[model samples]
Target chain A: MAGEVESIEKFLDEYMPSAELKEVKRLLYGKEIRLLEFPAEAEELAKEKDFELKGYGCDAARESSRLPKIVRIAGVQNKIVLPTSAPVAEQRDAIWAKISEIIRCAAICGVNILCLQEAWTMPFAFCTREKKPWAEFAESAERGPTTKFLQQLAQQYNMVIVSPILERDEDHGDILANTAVIISNTGDVMGKTCKNHIPRVGDFNESTYYMEGNTGHRVFQTQFGKIAVNICYGRHHPQNWMMYGVNGAEIVFNPSATVGALSEPLWPIEARNAAIANSYFVCGINRVGTETFPNEFTSGDGKPAHKDFGHFYGSSYVAAPDGSRTPGLSRTRDGIIIAEVDLNLCRQVKDHWGFRMTQRLDLYAEELADVNKPSWKPNIIN
Target chain B: MAGEVESIEKFLDEYMPSAELKEVKRLLYGKEIRLLEFPAEAEELAKEKDFELKGYGCDAARESSRLPKIVRIAGVQNKIVLPTSAPVAEQRDAIWAKISEIIRCAAICGVNILCLQEAWTMPFAFCTREKKPWAEFAESAERGPTTKFLQQLAQQYNMVIVSPILERDEDHGDILANTAVIISNTGDVMGKTCKNHIPRVGDFNESTYYMEGNTGHRVFQTQFGKIAVNICYGRHHPQNWMMYGVNGAEIVFNPSATVGALSEPLWPIEARNAAIANSYFVCGINRVGTETFPNEFTSGDGKPAHKDFGHFYGSSYVAAPDGSRTPGLSRTRDGIIIAEVDLNLCRQVKDHWGFRMTQRLDLYAEELADVNKPSWKPNIIN
Candidate 1:
């Protein structure tokens, strides 16, 4: 039996002939392998020889140049008074003041953006029968107080504001849309996107209050970068976020007002999922506190009933493209959470994960086009 | 104008005719709508009310059962003697004793399964000239001493052992296959899985050593459940894990002896990626210590050189399907980390995230088959 011996250089000469093995050799030579504690004599000898000892450890090569910029974001859970209240004007003023305070505090903390809960200025009024008079609160997007106030605040603090409201299109003669207004820092109304999908089941009587948003996925170019907003209930539909991403949204915001018993764990899941899938940053802003409105009138059937409202648990958070998160704001606390986000991290993640490079977008487009086909049904109640 | 007054009962009569409105009425009647507090008062109320809530800020439905059984897992980073080492029959007994001691200590900590680093019993002899004498270390799947000894200990302690070895088959003589031998608790040779993807890059001269794995992905059914082993470099491939999951592997083990500088961050990324993508538990084990061997000979160029062995970092860890990790076993510490894993959690995650439900497997199969087609390549890459 012959003993075949080969030095490290000989092995590299045979295996990596085309490459500059010297560079790799130079970088690794003489470094201590952190995982092992070598005998002092051996360590000293290795150091004397200038041989680099290598160990298993994390490399910061890809993460080196990327810097995360911290910005505060706030979500206000606004509760609107029922129509049966005596003075709607006075109630509206109080609600606006409360919302202003939230925006002001978020701006003071250097929040680049603040998102209000769904239908921020009003209660979920769609839960009741819609009378013609109830439409009074559904103001024009261009002329509404909510839009005007948010725009002014945007200019005041150099912040972008996303306000989901019952938008009345005056041009269409009182046609209402479930709309989200994006106000730019210069007090300009950049644009508005409507909810593409509306849930017809359960307590979400969204169709009764406003028509589905007509705008396709659109992101506004701001002083910071291109940003997009997906209103509450849209997160359940993954394509909504994807559409925003494909349209070049650097920062995507999901403004929501959901109760505590229904969706907390899913809270962390959604933003992370969106961030990873789209390779973009996701800000999940949830409203805190609770609201109780007065019952309209007595029951026709004489059954006992009382007014009830959702306790919006506030657990706002920001998820990076690689699915890492900064510590989120408390779900129970009514405060702002500021996180530094690096725009470069998106490119870094994309290069590393290669999801965008590997995504079959054309195939998805064809598949989604044929929505009538029967597919795998998961947790289908029907 | 007529003011239409409708009580909550009348509203429910018209809008929620199908709902058991009695439940909602019962929970809300005479109750103040205030924000819920820490211990999840809303959960208690909802449980009593017998109604399910679905939204943000809610706790997931608590499981009726207690926590699942915990098993500690440890990865042994072993250095194989390079093929150039002068064969010494007398050294086998000492080596066996040392390896046995490591396994015994791991078993004492309730480690049901211990995955030895790739080719645990022998050095990566392929680093130099290949000859028939190196085949002496190659072992048979059914009769290897490493397997025989580990099998005995497994039976004694009711443990399952995964031993990766340089394998030799007479029919295909000297064609090495980086393989993992699965030893069942009852001392049976369950089966073995060969490394699927072999890398030809870097210091990995795998092509010179072994043919690609003949067997595709495989999972072994042990007393503990179905387990699968992915060899060192195979961790870089995503489809490897996906195939294991489709074949019903509950726990996937990645046993590696990777050095630090070349690809360290990839260590944490690989295990967690497998766990998250496939919704299965992953145990990543690496060699924690360092090894140095005498240089047998010099290169033809006469540049003085020795066999430069790289240090293997030992940050072994166990990751849950939900992306939560028990603190990782330190790369510097020869220790164990144990955590109870609820197999049911996999189902829970799948149910909530709908990954499996939404996966169009047939389409993916077709796409992957032609992923490298010339037509599919972007012009820029070309």
Candidate 2:
């Protein structure tokens, strides 16, 4: 409205009182998980690296009895640096180079934990539905080169790093799975969780590559917070988000690689809704930019075949359990959003809202048992 | 940003392309169930009645074999015409008269199914916490004057009506429950569903009057569509919405009387999110204005005691399965939003989104069983 097209938040800010604006922000998101203003040195580095960086702080009302557990978390949304035709090693090395710099920037900004976009090490090639060269990109989750690369960065910066990658599970049968490996600040590789839900519509064609994640909703107990990852398409499933909260995650990162054409409308609402419904902080990190492939493809929508996956439209943002949210990052730029949130806010909002108290989990547990039954009938009163 | 503050939808419309604006509308609500344009006679009557009216239609893609089953549904939000000091019969008559006129208007507009706000016949008196006079409002769901009055109207117009009222169960120790009575088009007293999750937060204090709903997520299969009611505080629970969806509900009405200070932010998102997740139509109806009781009350918020319940901002609207929505009615006005929608869109969206197919019910069914256990531990990896 006043600034660049990306700055939609400024339009509301200019027209309304800060309180009312905060109300709307709170409706979509209330805990301001925005980009924190950097010191001059880091700003200079960001300028030099030609990447956008933003951050915010999610504060809790102070209590004399208990201290706040403020933890800094960062989400990086980015695009491929090199062409798909480039040698696989060079392409991965380019991403590694760019991410290493961003990780350094995160360290300077005091990010205690950071998560990269889904399959950050390679192109979003699931759309191709091809197996040969793309499957070659998959590597071991525990001892993969990507985890090895990030483990050093995690230890060096004393930061917890979540790396979503195409994992080659050699022990399981040389199968490939879309997975996120959590690297602790102590340079140890925590257990990994696979993408729970796979897309079958349009060009997502993820069913050809992997099935539903076998790992349950797993929360990694980190030095900063209890966190989990709802990878990519899993955001559409509210139950997936709910179980993670049930497992006592303080924060959940949605590392996704989705295009604007299929999911732009759902992008802003889903993660924010999950955060509000589950009473936890959520970081929605999406890959930016459209990548044109060497070959044409059809999305099965009866339209003409296309060469690209459409715009990823990166507008990564964060949501607090209180339903407060930060303004999203630039839709057209590679950027990272850093938010320092007090884990105490999670419990505080839960107490204030009483959502956990009122939510009748017993009701659903019984219903779901019947729901899974083959002879189940909906409770319809005709 | 454009005309009246009530028209927030206009701001986005004026600033962006129609398609992009449609995308935003699709996010919050896509099925544009809104008030249809009335005939000249109805318009004159609406003008004379001095009520705000708005409407829309939610369309579906054409299928060669199946015809579109467009059904109009209306939600009425209003203030109590007579103050609490007035005689109970006089107050009830005033509401009946006003609603009779609105129902007549709805009939003229060809509304197939209509739902009134929560506790529509009485002031939202749960804030007062005094039972002597307030409990007098509770009546039989089947034999109550409100049900009989609405039954005759429903039979006259051949339109189904949903009446949310405080129920007095004489057969069960005269207990009071928040219930919605479904009057079929044939004027038969269909089954009733009670408010599932009762509130204990702030001034709500609903638990003093009613326990959790005994009737589970019940869907009423009417001539129009299979629908359910998630009363007031139950909207705070995603599982409540999900269960109704599992019960094959095509539309879910959220009849609420929430105040601004406690729930204004959640008003817009919850029902809309339910629509998207559950692949159903959601009509979010809220009561308008503040009602001061004859006696003072404390909300237990550690604040000064007051006589009035805070304002019930009544920006009611409808959300479709595709995430499209109609613009809301005035926040501080007596109004009804009528929306014409095709129930087929629910299945269409489910087909497109693959949410039901990808949703791992078997997984949660197993997990929730453990979660319901007393000695269960979260899957937290240390």
Candidate 3:
């Protein structure tokens, strides 16, 4: 793995200035600006690197001639097609192997920040009502093997990795949370943001296993950009998305594992609204494929009992600050969506549309303070 | 118009138990149940009524055999297809005549609560940047001619009418606000909810004319159902929608005057998200057709100067608490959409989803109270 990382680095360092890179850059910048081309040996080296450099594109924006900055982001929406009812350890191993391949692919494509779907290490088994099999999947945020693997990749590629996992807080007596751990380019654990809103609808009885996030909306000042993670159900809460923008997040990632029946229509709405309302880029990721449990469950809609929790449609896409979005990745297959975003677009959009400047935070603060009161009123009838 | 209203009442009285009405009812309730029908003279009364009932659909759900209450809500998305540069009075009269016809149409369809688009009596001329012509469109929400006319219609049909108007709040020194006057079935003023969020983008430079609402989120308790209006720009704010639900709004209407390029993508997202997140029915209405102002305006997108504000794309639709949504109205024409929604679904969904019960409101209140503070921190890294 270490050797693979070095080869990937060598290929990237060599391929950074090729004519192919320039064409991709031109397509993004909208004008042809000459970029120096690397030697032919770099192409040969990439071929020999054993790293699949699939789907590469570059987007750059220059606020000024000298202040050019770009943030390349990737969303990995994977399917859990492993053998059904496999042992927990075997399931973990199979998932890890698939994730490693995608991470390598993202690194080869020069992604500065990469994000995985919520609880990426395990099947979404909380819906089964059989708690033990799923609870056994929870791991420490700091010492988890998933984190260790992501850290290695993050350091090797000088990339920031957002890994959402089922966290067992050993220090807090094994209290669980749907946590997103940020791994810095230096292979250090930057921090974690917990899932703020837990859905209890139908088969999404996530509260049966984990509690609502104790950590407030935390924006990580990573090497590439300022980023935040609004894990899964938090997307439905506007305030949850607003706080991240309030804390100055340039990009927010929503890593989710929601089924199609429960959230497909909502899938296109929430994250895109968050991006437009907050004036920031949003990368929406979802787990794909169907997962069947040992026992059947009913959705309370008077439907027949079913062992599967519907499809986890993986139509992951990136929405820009200007409310434009990219085409989603495959909904039934494992895939990676890489979007090249100009972080300056966040500033440009904020300036053009003064949603932040004109939000009237004071009014909302006063109103929100009164919402939970016993005698709260929505408005003055008089 | 009074004759039209009386004719509708006679028709409804006669058709209550007709076989045609039974088929529609059975299609909605998902089971065949006999319902008493109106006399045959009702069909003769409709023939003499001289009105057209546009698009209509029935959707109903009953949790049990006993709890059966249905609310039929209609959203009128009218276009200002009158001469674009007509006199202010002429424009007002023309718009009123068109809306009156739609009201009659809605009444004939047996709509219980009828909501018109934002400022339905006036052309959305804030984009023109010409003050006097647009300013003249403002009227007193309590006693304006539009309200008086709607009151008459409300009384004649026994319908709750939601009329969004550009309000001239004379008591407050002629200060203006985007106000929705809720007229009760008995021809009295129920109350008014002002638009809380005002847009300052491009042609939607509404802040220049009106201040943000001080009325906050007001839910009107009418005979048909408890309802609320979030008005146009407020739709982008999730808290705005949530507050109405908190105040026990079974149905929330978003009366809007937005354009295609600016908000078409968002049109489908916000109201549906509101319905699902708040577990209430959301009816979204927008004015139709394109308006050409006298002068050109720039949206800062580096495009050429344009006189028109693009298409309004009047795709009004309704979303249920169960996340199902009706298709939008016509994008290029004036239209009315009637949706038959079971108010019981709101409660049934809340019971199943438990979003309201499980929401950590205290945590959010504390967090929201700090957002405006200068020393607010998203999270403590240590």
Q: Best by TM-score, which number?
A: 2
lDDT assessment of candidate 2 = 0.86
- For A39-151, candidate 3 gives per-residue lDDT tens digits of 34433443453322223333445666546457778888776647548888788888888778777766766789999999998889887777767777788899988889889
**Candidate 2 wrongly placed segments (more than 4 Å):** A1-7, A10-35, B1-7, B10-35
Candidate 1 lDDT, B1-382, residue by residue in tens: 0221211223333433232333222222211112212225534433443322111111123576745534444555433332334463433455565566656555544567767767766555444444455557777777877788888988997888888887876457646678899888788888888887675533455667777686666678676657888887767655556667766777788887776654553455556656765767777877655554444433233545557435566666666565554334444433333434546666665655444554444444433333335464311100
Write down the DockQ of candidate 3.
Answer: 0.18
Name the 10 consecutive residues with the lowest summed lDDT in model 3 chain A: A1-10
Using TM-score as the measure, what is the rank order of every candidate, best first? 2, 3, 1
Provide per-model DockQ scores.
Answer: 0.02, 0.55, 0.18
Q: Which 10 successive residues of model 1 chain B have the least lDDT summed?
A: B51-60
Cα shift from native, residue A325, model 3 (Å): 1.7
Q: Whole-model lDDT, candidate 3?
A: 0.75
Candidate 1 per-residue C-alpha lDDT over A1-382 given as tens digits, one digit per residue, 9 for 90 to 100: 0221212223333433232333223221222212323346534543443322211211122455555544434444434433435365565666687667656555545567667767766666554444444566677777788788788888998988888877888898778887888887788887787776665433355656665465766777777667788877676555566667766777788877665444543455555567766778787777655555455422222545544444565656666665455434544444444444556666666665555654445433333333224662221111
For candidate 3, write residues B1-382 as lDDT tens digits: 1211112113322434454433322222223322223234433343454322334343455555656667779898877857667888898898888778777766766789999999888888887667877888888989898899999999999999999999999889998889999999899999898998888887788888998899877788888888999999888777778788877898999999997656666677678878887889999998877788777777656888888887787778788776667656666666777887778888877887676876666776777778767886655242
Model 1's i-RMS, to one decimal, reads: 22.0
> In angstroms, how far off is A320's CA in candidate 1?
4.4
Q: Using lDDT as the measure, name the better of candidate 1 and candidate 2.
A: 2
Chain B TM-score against the true chain B, each candidate: 0.74, 0.94, 0.85
Cα-based RMSD of the predictions, in order?
A: 20.1, 2.6, 10.2
